[model samples]
Target: MNTGAVLLYHAAQLYCNLYKVTDFQAKETAGIGVYSALSLINHSCYPSVKHYFIGRSLVMRAVRPISAGEELTISYIKPFQKAKKQERKILLQRYWFSCTCEACVNDWPTFPNLPALRFKCLGCKNPLDGRPRVCYACVTKRRDPDKPQTEQMEVVDSIWRGILNACCTDLALNIGQKKTREDYLTVCQNLQLLYEHVAMPCQHVIIMHQLLYKYFEDEF
Candidate 1:
C-alpha cells in the first residue's frame, strides 16, 4: 500500500548485498550487513580476498598475491564445504548466477571431495586429478628448452603431513594438543606452499585462506 515500501522491496531484490557478520572469536554468526562499497564486489567461488567486521566496520584483506588489473572478489558461499556441481547449483538457485571461476570452469573438487592427499604433475606441479600422465601445460612445457623441470613431487611429503596433522584438519580441532598462534601460523604457511603446487580451489589453498584470515586476526 505504501509507494516507498514498494520501491524499496524491488531495489532490495536487485541490489541487496548481504554478508554474514561473523564473530571469529566466538565462532558464531553475529548478524548480517549490507555495505554499498562491499556490495559492488562480485561473487567468486574462489575469492582473491576476504572481509571481516571490526566493531560494525568492515576490513578487507588479500589472502594471496594479486596481479595488477585483477578484479577483487569474495565468496558469499563456502566453496570448500560443497562439491563443484552442487556448489554451482546453489549459486545459480540462490543468486541467480552461475559461477565461472577457475574452480568451477575446470571442475575442481572441493575440500570435502578431496582425499587426504592428491597427485600433482611431475612437471608443472598442477593437480593431475584424473588426467592421464601429465597435464597439457606440462606437456607443452616439455617442448620448450628454456623451462626447467619441476622438483620431484615426493619432496612435498612433509608439507602434506603437516596439513594432515594440522589443528584445523579434522573436526575435533586437535583436542590432544593445544595449538598456539605460532602453531597455526606454521600450518597456514605450509598450506600456502601446498596451494602453489595444486590446482585452483585445491583444499590447501581454500583452507589456507580461511585459516590465514583467522591467524591474522589473532596476530593484529
Candidate 2:
C-alpha cells in the first residue's frame, strides 16, 4: 500500500480497536464488528435505543417510545459506573464532544452510593435512615427522642417488602421458556433498586447481584 493508504488503514484499525464494542457470551468473546453508521448516533446515560445483535446483523431496538425530531442516542458508557462529572469530562475528552444529554445536564444520582446504600450504619448498627448520612439513632434520636429507633424502619421495610414481592412474582412468571431479554433486564433493574434501598445486609442482596451477573453473562 502507498504511504497515504497505509496511514488511513492504520487510522481505521485504531478506531476499531478503541471504539468498537464487543458482543460476548459465557465470558467468551463471541465476535467483534463495526456499526459504521450507528457510530454516528450520539450518547446519553439514558439512551432512547439499545443496539445488540440479532444473529449476525446489528439491530437497534427502542427501549422506550420516541418522538420525531429527537436526536438519536446510545450510551457509550454504563449507567452509574462513574460519577456524572467525571464521566462527562471523560466522554468529552475521548469523543471530542461535550455531552448535553439529560442525565448529564440534570446531574442524576449515579449508583456510586451503592456501598453506602447497601449496608447498615457503623454506629448503632441500625439502618441508615436515608441517603446513607447516618443511622436514625445517631441523628434522628436527637430530634425525636420519644420516637422508637425502629420507627423509620416501618416505612423502609414496607417499601422493601413491596419490591421483594414484585420481584418474586416476576421471577415466577419468567421461570419457564417464556422469559425475554427485556424481562431479565427488568428483574435485574428491580433487584438493583432493592439492593440500593435495603440498608440491611441480607441474602437477597447476594442473590440480586448473582441474577444480574447471570443475565449480563448470557445476554451482554
Candidate 3:
C-alpha cells in the first residue's frame, strides 16, 4: 500500500479501538463489532433517544417526544445526573466536543418541570416559611374545639414517612436490571405527584427530583 493508504489504515484501526463495542453482554470480548450507521449518532448528556443491544443488532428509540427537524442524540456514557461546569468539561474531553445542552448551558439546574425547593404544610398545603410546628393555615384549625395540635402533627408525620419510604424503595428496586425507561420515569414522576398531593417539598423528595432530572430530564 502507498504511504497515504498505510496511514489511513492505522487511523481506522485506532478509531475502532477507541469507539467500538461499548460493552459485552455475555462473557466474550471477541464479539465486539462496530456499525457505520450507529457510529454516526453523536453524544449528548441530555439525549432525546436511547439505543440498546438486541441480539447482534442495535435498536434505537426516542426516550422523549421529539420535534420535527430536531437532531437525534444519544449518550455515550451514563447520563442521568447533572455535573459542575468544570466537571462537564472534563467528562466531554473523552468525546472531544464542547457541550451546550440545556443542562450545560444553565450549569445544570433541576429539570424545567421542577422549579422550587419550598415545602408545603401537611394541613393546609401552603408553602412553609421555615420548619415549624404549625402552618398559618392550620393554626386556627388546630385551635378549634375538636382538633388537637399534637394529634394532627403526629398523623402528618406518619403519613409523610410512609410516602417517603415507599418512593425510596420503589426507586431502589427499579435501578436494577430489567429496569426500563418507564420504570425509572414512573418513580420520578410519582415522587413529584406525591409532593403535590402532600403539598410539601421534602429533602428526600428534592433529592429524588434532582436525581431523576439528572438521568431523565430529556425524557419528559
TM-score of each: 0.65, 0.48, 0.45
Q: Point out the worst 10-residue segment of candidate 3 by lDDT.
A: 211-220
lDDT of each: 0.64, 0.54, 0.55
lDDT of 2 by residue, 1-220 (tens): 8999998996765552334334534234456666677877878766766665545566665543367998878777664234565756675575666777766676655553334334444345555544443355666334443343354455446545645654664576567533357656565455555544455234454445445444443433
Return the lDDT, model 1, position 15: 48
Residue 117 C-alpha lDDT in model 1: 45
Candidate 3 residues lying further than 4 Å off, grouped into runs, are 1-31, 80-82, 109-220
Q: Which predicted model would earn the best TM-score? A: 1
**Root-mean-square deviation per candidate:** 5.5, 9.8, 10.5
Pick by lDDT: 1 or 3, better one: 1
Off by over 4 Å in 2: 1-27, 80-82, 112-170, 173-176, 180-220
Tens digit per residue, CA lDDT, model 1, 1-220: 6999998886776544777777755778888777778878987776787788766778887777677999998877765446565756665566768778776776667677655445566566765655353366566334433222234244366676776666453334435433466667677567666665555555556665566665545433
Location of the lowest summed lDDT over 10 successive residues in candidate 2: 140-149
Model 2: how far is 164 from its true place, Å?
8.0
